[model samples]
Target: MNDTTATLDAPTADDALTRPFPGASPYDTYVHASLLNSLQQPLTEAPDEMGFLVTTQVMELWFTLIVHEWRTARVAFAKDDLDAALDALTRSRRALTALSGAWAPIAALTPARFNGFRAAFGRASGFQSAMYRHMEFLLGDKNAALLHGHSGDRAVHEALGETYREPSLYDEVLAFLHRQGRPVPAHVLDRDVTLPYRADPGVVETWRQIYTGPQHHPHLTLGELLTDIAELVTRWRSEHVMVVRRAMGAKPGSAGSSGLAWLQRRAARPVFPELWEVRGAC
Candidate 1:
């Protein structure tokens, strides 16, 4: 093996604690881990509450990172900077995988353990997570009802409402493909930006062209990257459903929906529907 590979494979001990630094280590100043640690104020004495709170906060941070990456990809796509877009997408994919894994801390909580702290928070649930909604909006999961859920908080509602009105990252992608000589329909490209993206047959055909084209083409690489992203998004939803099922069974959600059942329906739908549909034809 090469020296670089061997070095990467080697293990190092006491690398963090043994290191010396000035006031507030560089990581602390940048990441504000100390400030973050102070935010986990569990409202109840339940042992599981801390894990649940921390897990949710961690997911929020991942969601924020994923949203930032997606916005970068969207701008790169708009400028026809395919390599930059691809780099951003790859970063978002890794962030999405980490986000999915963030469920572990609270993944297997019993209904009893969850109940111990569920009522203490009243109507607060993951459903009210603004950063999570930002990630969804970028994926074209725009929902007016979900945006309205934050009306009590003017700043949050305005930010979410703006996203709800904007064309999603997928919308920008199709526009990019059209400029690259794909046959994406003008109607699909011009559809109202406020609505949730639905599967379009013409869009499916456009993806089919990419799939049927010469192997190793850049557009095909783009398609595969998008597929990876789509799969990751579905995985997150599935994991959420699993976590909710284990913690609440068929009971109503803290947000008023039929907890596991509601999430099950949401998880059943694909994020990039046309991307998945095109696979069958190819």
Candidate 2:
């Protein structure tokens, strides 16, 4: 090649990708990596504390993403946009999978290792996580008391209260199904959105129909996607319980919860209960 052609083809030190910016890198600006990295201020020198703190923070980000996707799916369902709804649910399933995997770092902390830093951050339990509560509310586990727990923070309380008042993701799914000629109960369709969702026999039968119908049906695909999401959430909670058991062994949680026992009970409650219930009928 000629010298000019060679110069055009060759790499240069001034390439935009290699050029330094005057301030923070473009990636850091977009992702706020500096802010995120700066937030992990471990209260103690204990090595395990850093991993614990980071893992918890990582889960929070995942919770935020999952909640966002669930809300998107809820709106799409309301508009009878099945493709968009399914896409959002699929994204949320991936997020939930990552959230479940986040336990790895602190998953095996011995009681002694955990104790080394546990007391340093007293009364800051995982139970106090507002984002996690948002995820629960989106899953139809509305609890007014839990929403009230963040009353001290007006912004957080208001945001959570709105989610608390709105129809849950599953509620929208049922409404969509009803619009599509499924026999979702009138009472279920008209129930107070603020209240916790109870598994209705009618709803179970609706899902049962979907489950027992043609295997390639779009509605059946939706049911299976929801089931996958539920199973991932259950697995995440179960893993959390096991991690707490291994790390602290039935000790009280940092946020005044019963810790392992509380988590175990919470894990037992299935997400999208009707979807799971229909499986047995099928």
The estimated TM-scores of all candidates read 0.90, 0.95
Candidate number with greatest lDDT: 2
What's the CA error at residue 262 for candidate 2, in Å? 0.8
- Cα RMSD (angstroms) for every candidate in the order listed: 6.8, 2.2
Give the Cα error of residue 254 in candidate 2, in Å: 2.1
- Runs off by more than 4 Å, candidate 2: 1-14
- Cα lDDT of model 2 by residue, 41-103, tens digit: 999989999999999999999999999999999999999999999999999999999999999
Candidate 1 clashing pairs, residues 3+ apart or interchain: none
Candidate with top TM-score is: 2
Score residue 132 of candidate 2 by CA lDDT.
95
